[model samples]
Structure formats: C-alpha cells, structure tokens
Target: EINEIIRHLNNSAPGSDNLSSFFFKDTIDYVASIITHLTNESSRTGQFPDILKEGKIIQLPEISNAINFSELRPITILTVLEKILEEFVYKQLIDYLDEKNSH
Candidate 1:
C-alpha cells in the first residue's frame, strides 16, 4: 500500500504538471502522514521492527548511508514502519516531525 503511493508519485513526477506545487505539497503531506502513523503505531505497540529500530536516530550519518528516499517505494515505507512500530520511541520522532511540518 505504501509502495504504491511512492510508485505513483515517482511515475507522475509532480514537476511535469502545471499544478506541481500542489502536487508536491500533497505528496509531502501524504508522506508525512505515513511517517506520523507509523510512529504513533510503534509507540503504542512497542514492536519496532529491525529496520526502523536501526533507524532510531534520524540524524545518524548511517541513515545517509542507508537506503535513499528517492529509491524508496511505499512497500519499503511500510516495512520500515513495521520495524519502527516495534519500538516505543518512534512516537516521539513522529511527534517531532509533525510539529515541525505543521509550522
């Protein structure tokens, strides 16, 4: 489900459209929502999966060394979330991003 969203966004490339700004904003919002959801779910369940557990710190240099967002699919996002939600800390990360993105 998540991979489908990424695939669709990449295939449609918002830059190609007159409504590129809107598309970009919507895409960002959608991606943010997914992140937010995963974080919240992870917090409640204490079941952060290995990948997300590995990505606990968003600012890690290792993150940059890991998979690139440009190459990520929705399924990847889902997998990451599945891993992340296994831990309780992911909620904090989601809250931070939500607060930042809200403004």
Candidate 2:
C-alpha cells in the first residue's frame, strides 16, 4: 500500500490540497504508518472523512476543444489524504474482484 502511494506521489500531480505526492513520497517513511492508521480507521468506520473529499474542480475548455462550458473537461484535485484513500479503496475493490474471480 505504501509502495502504491509512493508510486503515485512521484508520478501524479498535486491536488487542490496543494499537497503533492512528492511531499509525501519524500516523507513516506515518516507518514506511512500514520496514513495506514487513518486508512484503517476510515474503513472500520465505513466513512470517508468529509475534509478529504473537499476538492477543487478545474475546468479545462481549451483542452476539451469545445466552446460550450458544459463541454469542458472538469478535473478534480483531491487532498493528499483523499488521494491516498482513493488508492486504498481501489486496491480493495481489485482484490475483491480477483478473489471472486478465483472462486
């Protein structure tokens, strides 16, 4: 899990939280345990923190190549913590699917 987070930190862009993966990656060793704890708490409670989900929507009309505002591509910049949660949830889903497939 830490490895996956680290991978994203190095390759992904900073989110609205203004916390870049590089920041966490460089300090992964120090924060990995804390993140793991938070991850577990979030799962056991079956609730994601409201703060983590607070992200900014970046609209890119030029990139979307559309004149209509609705046609613009919207990107979500999640907090670093939220990004980690997203990865953790993704892994859980993948594992569940793989387990079911093996049945």
Candidate 3:
C-alpha cells in the first residue's frame, strides 16, 4: 500500500526536508520496510512525529499578472512520508466510519 501510494505521488517540490516524492518513489524498494514500521508504530502509539508534520509554504500567483497578496495562493508542500502517513490515517478513519454505519 505504501509503495502504491508512493508510486502515485506527483513529482512535485519537496517540503521542509527537501526530499521530493520522486525520491521516495525511486527508493521505495529499500525504504518500504522502514516506512511500514514507522507507520505501524505511529498508529499503535497514536502519536505522530513532529518532524514529519513540518511543511514548506510558498505563495504562488493565481493569475499570471498578479499584483497583490489577495491574488496569491498559499501552497503547503509536505513530505512524501507525511503524505503516506496521512493516507494510512485516512484509510483507518474511513474504515471506522464504514463499520459504524454498517452497525
């Protein structure tokens, strides 16, 4: 699942860590076990590392000829690891909700 998620991630600019999604995709074979362990540990402990939560915010103009701050959009670039963690949490939440609804 982690590998699938990493495979689908866009090759966009990295966050505070400066490691892009492409990097993860390229190294998934070597890093899959470590990432899976990290994700599982985080889930079991119900705690996420502060380092993974860090993001880099950059403002880009909504229009080509933008003139003011209002015309700009803030894009928060997060690490691929953070995104993977989010996907795991999201799947768990959805599964919980589905189970609740089924009952």
Candidate 4:
C-alpha cells in the first residue's frame, strides 16, 4: 500500500519535517516498514504524532501582482508521513463506500 501510494505522489514542497516526496520514493525500500508501522499505530491509537499534524502554511498569490487577501490562496504543506496516512484512510473510506453501494 505504501509503495502504491508513494508512486502516485507529486514532487511537492516538504512540510516542517523537511522530507520531500523524492526522499520517500528513493528510500522506500529502506523505510517502508517504519512508515507503515507509524501509520498503523496512528490509526490504531486514533491519534497522530504531533509532527504528522504540523504543516507549513504559505500564501500564494493568484496573480503576479496581488494586493488583496482574496487574491492570495493559503496552501498547507504536510509531511510525507501525513500524506501517506491520509491516502491509507482515503482508500479505506472509498472502499467502504463502494462496498456499501454495491449491496
């Protein structure tokens, strides 16, 4: 699951952990188990590590010359771990919905 999720991730900016998508894809063979464990633990415990919840919010201007607050979009950059965990839960939710709808 981790490998499948990581394969589709974009090379976006890193969060507070400073870990990028490339880092995960490159080191997946060596780190997949550790990440999987963390993600599973988080799911079992119903609580995520503080770092996983942390994100860096940056405001990007909609136009080259932005002057108003509405012109700026706030983007939150979360860690690769967070992204993986999210994908896991998302896939589960989608599967559950699919199964429910099938019956």
Candidate 5:
C-alpha cells in the first residue's frame, strides 16, 4: 500500500527535483508511524478500546478533522485499510505471543 502510494506520487510528479516527492514520502512515513503506534498500544491493552468502547464506535473528531478530503487528491482509501490490516495483524501476533508465554 505504501509502495503503491510512492509509485503514484513518483508517476504524478515525474521528477525527483520537486517538493511533492518529499511531501509524499513524509506522508507515507507519518502513516506508517501511526499504524505502528496504534498496533503497539492495542497489543499492550488487548484491544482498541479508545476506538470502540462498550461496542460503540468512538468518534475521533481530531483525526477526522485532520484528514481533509478536499486536499487528499492523491490519497486513496486503501491506504487507511492497509494500515488497519497491519494493526490487526500486529495485535494478533502479540496475543499469540502472550498466550505462548503463559503456557
């Protein structure tokens, strides 16, 4: 998913001399960092409770407001989905590890 973003950014920019490349790279890095943080937090806590409390989806206005759809011309929804998948896998791996350790 990150690769696809980079590919698209590179294709769209068509030159390394532009600042857009840096922006795209930074955005990808930021997304990766967020995914890692969320995964680690969820793993330690056993679930994403802040995101879902009492079976209700929590509305994170800060995050929602930060993501400007109008300015997200090159960003695809798949990027968010991929990050979610990564977080889920990380949590599952951590759970498996904990279970093995307990046994």
Candidate 6:
C-alpha cells in the first residue's frame, strides 16, 4: 500500500500550502510509518485529520476562455498527504475486490 500510494503521487502544481508531491516522494520513508498508522486509525475510526481536508478550488477557463462561471471548469487541489492517503484507500478497495472475485 505504501509503495502504491507513493506511485500515485502526481507531479502537479502545488496548492496554497506550497507542498509539492516531490516533497512527499523524497521523504516517504521518514513519513511512511506514521502514514500507515494514520491510515489504520482512520479506517478504524472513520476519521482523518482536518489538515488533510484542506483544499483549493480553482476555476479554469473553458475552450473559448469564457468569463461565465458556467463555462469554467472547477478543480480541487488537495494536499499531497491527502492524495497519498486516498491512494492507500483505493489500493485497499481494489485488493478487497480482487480477493472477493477470487473466491
């Protein structure tokens, strides 16, 4: 799961926190243990840190660069940590499905 989470980190632009995926990629080992613990805790308690919930909603212009809000595409930029945890959840779900299908 750790490796899968690391693999899913995107090389996208940073958010307001100014944290890039590279930062997590470079220091994954140092944070892996804690991340694993957090994942387990979150899974058990159905809760996660509020910091992970922080995100930025940015609007991108449509094909014609229209000023109307309806023509803009909104994208949410979540923290790198959140992204990693999300990937962990995704892997867990996929593994569960695979195991079920093998039965």
Best TM-score goes to which candidate?
Answer: 4
Locate the minimum summed-lDDT window of 10 residues in model 6: 1-10
Query: Sort by TM-score, best first: what order?
Result: 4, 3, 6, 2, 5, 1
Model 1, 1-103: lDDT tens digits are 3333333443221211223333434565466467557666755796654543332222223344556665433321223233223332544567789999999
Better of 4 and 5 by TM-score: 4
What local distance difference test score does each model get? 0.43, 0.78, 0.85, 0.86, 0.48, 0.83
Please say which candidate is ahead in TM-score: 1 or 6: 6
Q: Pull out the clashing pairs in model 6.
A: none
lDDT: which is higher, 3 or 4? 4
Model 5 clashes, total count: 0
TM-score computed on alpha carbons, candidate 3: 0.86
Error of 6 at 30 (Å): 0.7
Query: For model 2, how does the per-residue alpha-carbon lDDT over 1-103 read when each residue is reduced to its tens digit?
Result: 8556666764566776678777888888888888888888988998777777688888878554588887787888777777777778888989999999999
Number of the top candidate by lDDT?
Answer: 4
Tens-digit per-residue lDDT, 1-103, candidate 4? 8888987888988888898999999988977888788778877898878767788899999998999999999999888778888998899889999999999
| Candidate 5 local lDDT, 1-103, one digit each (tens) | 3344343443232222233444545577566566557557876887764323212122333444446545333422223333344546766679889999999
What is the TM-score (0 to 1) of candidate 5? Answer: 0.31
The count of residue-pair clashes in candidate 3 stands at 0
RMSD of 2: 2.4
Question: Which consecutive 10 residues in model 2 have the weakest lDDT in total?
Answer: 2-11
Clashes of 2: 1
Q: List the residue pairs that clash in candidate 3.
A: none
Query: Between candidates 2 and 5, which one is better according to lDDT?
Result: 2
Listed in order, each prediction's TM-score against the native is 0.29, 0.80, 0.86, 0.89, 0.31, 0.86
